[model samples]
Target: MDTIGHHYIVEAAGCDPNVIGDANKIREIFLEAAKRGNMEVKASYFFKFSPMGVSGVVIVAESHISVHTWPEKGYAALDVYTCGENADPEKAVDYILEQFKAQYAHVSEIKRGIEEEDRTFTHTILTWEERLDRRNGKP
Candidate 1:
């Protein structure tokens, strides 16, 4: 199987103190950022009062973006996961950071793919080998 995708985790600290605690405000921030990043959002939800703070998720056609806000600590956690060659999650991350006016941010990106695995006959060969071994009474 061909697996190609990109996933990003972005965390921000010392966000604009004003924007950190409210779920509604956080939702608005994400909506605006999505527009700025040119991402197509299908649906979104936000919730407040988690131990970690407020949390929200935006389900996008490209993938999804999620945020957790901690106004008490002036921190927010973000994650963006996307598949397909054209999904630019980095733009989304940058837009979010800019919107929140994050003072210190940490971003981690991971590229996913399958490299050099013989897919054609490996399964068939393995099955045949297993059958032969069974016939030979080798558990």
Candidate 2:
């Protein structure tokens, strides 16, 4: 189907708190993820919270990748959106999860700006979960 963009909404759990709490590391991770996903990075910024947490965004030519973290809960929320044909949001998401060492993740993908025959626009959503630490064939 033809659409304007792909947006990935992700919830990652069982991650390393330290990794997610570090703003500098997250900025680095996001930049690398943009490269890994074949995205053209225009600019980026990240902020670290007192106590424990972080928030950040990487703006790309196609769209952007953003994240928020709760270190105390070992959880993170991420959004990867892109409209360019050359951009791979999935690859970027995967890299982010791997870098955070997430043991489990729930991902929802939305096909945005779906134009109908009547010139209307709509979106489609698909959701799934991954058990990244499936040791001994068990999640």
Q: What do the candidate models score in CA lDDT, each in turn?
A: 0.68, 0.89
What are the C-alpha RMSDs, in order, of all predicted structures? 17.1, 3.0
Cα lDDT of model 2 by residue, 4-102, tens digit: 999999999888887899999999999999999999999998988888799999999858999999989989999999996888999999899888888
TM-scores for candidates 1 onward, in order: 0.72, 0.92
Model 2, TM vs. native? 0.92
Instruction: Flag regions of model 2 displaced more than 4 Å.
Output: 1-3, 134-139
Q: How would you encode candidate 1's per-residue C-alpha lDDT over 12-92 as one tens digit per residue?
A: 776765676777777887787677656788999988885547879998775788988877777788887776765677677
Q: After superposition, how far is residue 1 of candidate 2 from its true place, in Å?
A: 16
